[model samples]
Target: MPLILDALCLARDDAPVRRLIDALGTEPVETTERRIGEPAVLSQHLLFGSGGEIVLHDDAVVAVILHLAPTPSAPRGLDAAEWLPGVDNDATFADFKATFDVPWRFADGDRYFVLEAAYLRPEFVKHGGRRAGDLQRVAFTVDDPRETCRPADEDCPVCRELIVRTGDGSFDLDGTVDALVAGVEAGVLKESSGAVSLADLRLLHASALMERVESQVTCTACGRVACLTLYRDAPPTFGYHPLDAAMRRPLEAIPPVEEWGDAARIAEVRDAMRYVDHEPGLWFLVEQHGDLYLDSRYTISSMADDSCLIRLDEAERQEYHEAGRDSLTELARRIDRSGPHREASPFHRRNLLRHPDEGRDYSAEVRAAIAGHTWLARQKQAAAQRAQAGSAADG
Candidate 1:
């Protein structure tokens, strides 16, 4: 039985191929291009030599398999514990990292060995294998926050409490670990250890910290913003005032209030309008004088008293004509440019129109608009009640 050590790593390029060849101290006896895997085939290079086998693909050293020769005088397989320390060292780990430059910043880039029988499976045989259960596997990853954090303008208390900086400007891993342990002990960060995915670990820490802070605070160390405060001693104490109708209107419902060539075009147009109302796929702007400019998606019409008086502009008329809407074009043409017209219909009472292709849900926008209207109505009723009470008292 032969003992095998399989190391999976990311490589920056094929440069690690040459490095591995040097480290192994053996020339390849056989080299072949092989497509491995089923359903999704992967193109890989298989190199067989006296040392072991190397699998390479897309500038990544998918696996580096080492075969330990058995000695007649010793046990059938090499000692797994003895070989584990050799790969964990800086010199060995750096070479391992070079072979698999997987564009990740690994935290505590140490090799951990686990003995398993699954290494003998036929699927993993391309990376080199034998019938022996004395197989060790190691994985490297760049998913640590300490590896990703950058210096910030203002230090975040949470980050400062978690990360520790060394004299060389690199993170002090041991110190950082100590800080993390302290955070957990103090109930400021969640406890995570052994086998937990790096992403999950980071999330646990984030969720724990967010429960303590109220306002948005940016971490000076990593430049991450924490805004959600999940836990509070008591509910916020403040009067809740509703926003104005204009402020509450959805951005999609608001038209661009600008004249084509004027500097203060938007301001001028906005100043002249009383308010805008929207329903589903249609919206209208009501002028200060009560005249309505409506956009039905298909036509831009100027209306009063439930009647379509005229098209607002030549562009609008052309649009309707181009769309083959003959009735709307004819209606725009027949409108009498006479002296007086009736007042525009109340927005709430009018029958709303919809566009053929507009499938989006405008219920939220409609609800927001209704809330604004209700708030305004309540304000007016309150003022009237106040005035009537004052009049009765005076009489």
Candidate 2:
């Protein structure tokens, strides 16, 4: 049988077909691709920073020159922050970010394209065999990784901690110093092995550092500001350090930062950050490496430069968290716009909008993602607000 007779031939122009045919040569799938889940890599563009770590999933970073869809409301420029209640990097970004999904940034010259995830969920699940009862897990776009440099269905907490450590373990940063000495000796400490020289410790100290300090977050709604000292262990340990939230009054503080060794105390506080479920932010943990380096698009530990984690004053952390909430809340608004999009084919299940007969497309998938993002963001934001409101009311 000749090519294009399988009944799933999506409409196409003759010129494009000739080009595609030339590119694929004589391969069967190449000459006659039809399925939505074809093996292909979905790529987009991003603004590569001049500093910090950014390791894309396949090093296949292409420029995303997005031409506005040509409508009044069509976004004129790239402003990812405008989207509220953003998706956690893992769910939408993790195996789901593909050519099908939207790009956050674009390159200057080239029009972008999409390719495969290297590992497709359909192929993965199919290989595992017919156990339908199991909750199916499918990856869309994977988090841009720094170390691995490719998408894999696993977690690396080491990477997470590494990013954190390199960035600023916490607010408790003592100005970062290469010390020109090893963490073991040329500086002042010895290795666990005791045999390792001080020079070797210097290698480990090469990462970035930040110190823990007092901070507060102001309410965007009520304009009420909450003052609190940062703590080493729990949110309670940090926020209620003076134990004031409990008493609803400031008083003689209990244990103070000086009582505890800065290094040990800082470690505990840093560890606690991994658990805080604050309103999500644009940058997040895509890969974790033993609570150390957190791999993400803009995170990195691989470099020659050095910078100190500026000790944030009371107002900084508050501002940081507030900005984060706004970022997430805005992402929530993007979902509302998705409902207007078209869907794949009439044959596709769970499709809500009218079919265009043109064939399967990204409408349904993007819409579903946006809707889910909106719901989750609102739930989290509401819960946070209620907690803060309850606290304020009690005081």
Candidate 3:
């Protein structure tokens, strides 16, 4: 008998793979390249000791196929249902065929158990295909407080009174309690007659902030907080951080300091600083006490006496910062300097034609460089438009 687990839809990450391997309790015995479909798409098939096989395409586990012995003899080898639940353990050959709609002709012993992907795949895809097992936080806002409150409880009197006075059971945690308290004081609701006081409810609501209503799990691969689940309607929703727009844009496309203002420029500089050690596109050159400190993705080096590149260690980096040098200002200046001629050589004589001390304000210089880059970009855009217009006229 054979068991087919279809449409796993597992992410192309190591987390799920590692979990699968652990659950199986054995490493893959052999791996072989297999081709399928009319177009002959390549896939990797991993064979396990338990007669279970996993098919992978683009590192995503798409299917798992396992072979089981005939029933009545207690079916030898691994049990697929133990790892993947909801599979029938005591199904007959006829039952398997009828359940899975197996089209092929088979002998009495050739039974098949098919575990459909619908049981697992939909939830995985719903949560942004993240390897995190399940949602940590699930919250919802209701239109009626009575919908969530117990009707038989001691607070029922107050709850009913609230529904009548407020015109509906809907609540605003901040303002509703005060209104309820006021109503009780005005003798509209009985607060002392075994009803839960509005003050106690207010205290309980405030204490909820300290309770663990949600959990956060950091992804081991990206070291980022995993996706969150929110319920705004009947079906739940999951969200991920928006794509990195700044990284996607070319450096020239970044708005100039004058357009973005001082606060925005400062924010950009700070954000870029975080990636200085990891982003190849970002670099910084700082001058401190006649020594030039060059920081890039690969290495942090210092140059003194206009020669001799010395790599800085952790201690040297700390000392450099403690020496009271204007690194931020210098970084802004360098960004300004590189904006116009990013593709050209940094040491090109034309690039260095303006002396380093020509601009006293580094922020102003950065603004000027950004302005120049913007002007050049506009000029190229205008030139492209003119060429396009000429082509249209010719056509």
Q: Kindly give the stretch of ten consecutive residues in candidate 2 with the minimal lDDT sum.
A: 29-38
lDDT (tens digit, per residue) of candidate 3 on 1-395: 11233224554346656566545445776776643211223457665666455666556665554433322212344564564333343433333335455232211111112132321111111322133322111111111111111111111233322211123533233453454456546654332211123433333223332221111122222222212121223221111111121111122122332333346544554433121221123434433333443432221233311111123335556655776335434443443444423345342222322333454443333333234334434545654564455345334
Off by over 4 Å in 2: 1-117, 121-130, 140-158, 164-395
Ranking by TM-score: 3, 1, 2
* TM-scores for all predictions: 0.19, 0.15, 0.22
Model 1 misplaced stretches (Cα beyond 4 Å): 1-13, 37-41, 48-50, 69-83, 86-395
Off by over 4 Å in 3: 1-7, 70-76, 84-90, 93-395
Clash count (model 1, backbone only): 11
Q: Can you give the lDDT of residue 102 in candidate 3?
A: 26
Candidate achieving the largest TM-score: 3
